[model samples]
Target: MTLPRFRPRGWVAATKAAQRRHQAEAAGGPRGPAPRSQRAALYVHWPYCEKRCSYCNFNKYIPRGVDEAAVRSCLVTEAQTLLRLSGVRRVESVFFGGGTPSLASPHTVAAVLEAVAQATHLPTDAEVTLEANPTSSPGTRLAAFGTAGVNRLSIGLQSLDDAELRLLGRTHSASDALRTLAEARHLFPGRVSVDLMLGLPAQQVGPWLGQLQELLRHCDDHISLYQLSLERGTALFAQVHQGALPAPDPELAAEMYQKGRAVLQEAGFRQYEVSNFARKGALSTHNWNYWQCGQYLGVGPGAHGRFLPQGTRGHTREARIQTLEPDNWMKEVKLFGHGTRKRVPLGELELLEEVLAMGLRTDLGITHQHWEEFEPQLTLWDVFGTSKEVKELLEQGLLLLDHRGLRCSWEGLAVLDSLLLTLLPQLQEAWQQRTRALVPGG
Candidate 1:
């Protein structure tokens, strides 16, 4: 089955006027509705990479004679600006995602962490995660990162086969990946996570399972197994479209996913999100906040964020995106104190859509409490439970809604896109009815 991909809409960088207005509002002008919660997650994006991967479509560039210090300063400044704008005083987690955050100097990481701590109350035990590429993270660098306050290391191994690694345009060999994993485990112990990709071109289920089994022995508590998605505009996409490379077999991919889940289960890992698996007490707090639709601030080029606008007067949330180009982003930050390119306030339906899109991807579906927190005006059942489609979905074993709240069943997860296509319209109609009811003379 072809699962539909849902990308959240309404992201653009902030205009100068909008930036000024946002600043003015944040400075204690007229206050609006506060966010559902004040505690938030922090995401720091690093936009530079040592080499471009064939399948990556993220906003990243191979730097040439770049000013690293200036970039680091811009990141710290942006983080401070965003923290003030968000009015979020407590941080639940901090994630350093990137073009390659592992490429950053330990001092740079420490600087950003220090700035965050100064602006907000980052708890002593908060999860501070840094994404590392096997090639960029040597043993010494990993140790330095640990010293710099990065407690969790998410290493990108991608594949364990040397041939597959080359085909994926990775600079590191299979041995390099293993070596890095070993070093990371030694340094971080139980705090290490490894990312692996399945569904590569011409990949067979047996061989893929073998690679997974091999990784299971070396990996730490968490494992993020993602199916390779050939995004449009990526080199892999171009190659497949041009018939130079064969596309991955969907049936084989599905088989790999199912079998891989079993393997992890046997190894004592629980599937938390659709793509994320972890042992007890090893779930990723940062990613969990994301799936729960909690507020987070994004800093650096092309980063995206969702938070309650400090001065907004309603339950609506703001979606923020940073400037995509590194140099331009820094320039904008220098002028406006942030590189925010656009700030879109989500409507009720949009918010509900986001809630479902993110929440349902995990085992903890949308709880009644979470729903009420997100949109206090309506309950989960009030919006979706009354629908005929929902009834059918529940009867068909594709959805579960009870005291635990609404979530997809195991069968439903495989076809989540199809399920959402059926449910989103129901959400829109429900929200519309709620709006009309709130009118004085409706």
Candidate 2:
């Protein structure tokens, strides 16, 4: 199969105004009574890995001397509770993420999926993804998992280099990763995704680019290329601190990222988001919802969720996080019928900040229509229109703003951290003013 090459030559300021206007007009269409749609996704976390990687920081535990049956039961029960609370009739996507969801018994995965379908109206075509470790022999049982309800598979193949995989404390060999990917593709066809990480201890741009090129030969359409961040609590962090392992250089990592972006573009993959690339309709719907600031329900250990309450008046969103410990989560679920350890109602300012932060991470940016969906009283321009910093960023060619909304250019995304430092304060001040006026006492 031949793939088309994409050139980023015309993404300039001269055309941005037109693009922004078109996006805005397209977003604000007929305001008719719509069918009941959830406009949300579901995340079920299975926090157990066969062998924990050194660079990992996500909540995960080793499956040893643990009551596997009870843990599985808790996951199913929590999923049911979330479905009831959500009151969503149609769910767009369901993601099974984890330490290694594939490591769980196929029967258990099927049982939880069955419960989810029964509780909520999960259409047959909804994107159901299961995250798996490449070493977990998932290909051998891909048929069963597919029969159970999973339509997509995301494999955590951090690095294709055997030496680097060893340094990253991966349990699978390079050959094992490749074989498993090939088998999964053969079984599941075009519904497989592979993850690759750059900025390893001693990774070079040349080698990283070659690895990406080789990986595409076995992958379907989706690829998640992430920068390696050494979190504070991870084993790799301690090793780097103690001089046992060398840390990745920022400049070299940036070079790797740029090179990989060009290579993927040439391979017919579009960089829809900062770290994600897909060809045509192969985008990960589950993750796309999160990036677009859409609502989702998360259950299981250490999982987090954000949603607008069913009967809330204002745009005050609620953030929910379940207990991190498996035993504690199960106990809480048994006692209270749910495992939510903390549920905080996010204020308007907090919600705006979140929408801006998450939306800017994607290529589409945030539109006025999207903002008004949550808070009809205010638009993004009402807040950032008069800010000198926003104007300066636009003049500097870092931001694209028209009658529709604001979005970062490719250049802006490169320095998003520093750009946010300048852009967020103005919006925050506006939000503060709006809140103060809403409160009655002077």
Residue pair clashes in candidate 2: none
Task: Please tell me which predicted candidate would have the highest lDDT against the true structure.
Answer: 1
Q: Give the runs in model 2 whose Cα sits over 4 Å from its true position.
A: 1-39, 309-315, 436-442
**Per-residue CA lDDT of candidate 1, range 303-404, in tens?**
999988678776678999999999999999999999999999887678779898999998778888888776888888887778998999999999999988
Best by TM-score: 1
Candidate 2 per-residue C-alpha lDDT over 81-132 given as tens digits, one digit per residue, 9 for 90 to 100: 8767766655678899987887765556666666666665565577889887
lDDT of 1: 0.84
Lowest summed lDDT across 10 adjacent residues in model 1 is found at 3-12
The local distance difference test score of each candidate is: 0.84, 0.78
Cand. 2 TM to true fold: 0.88
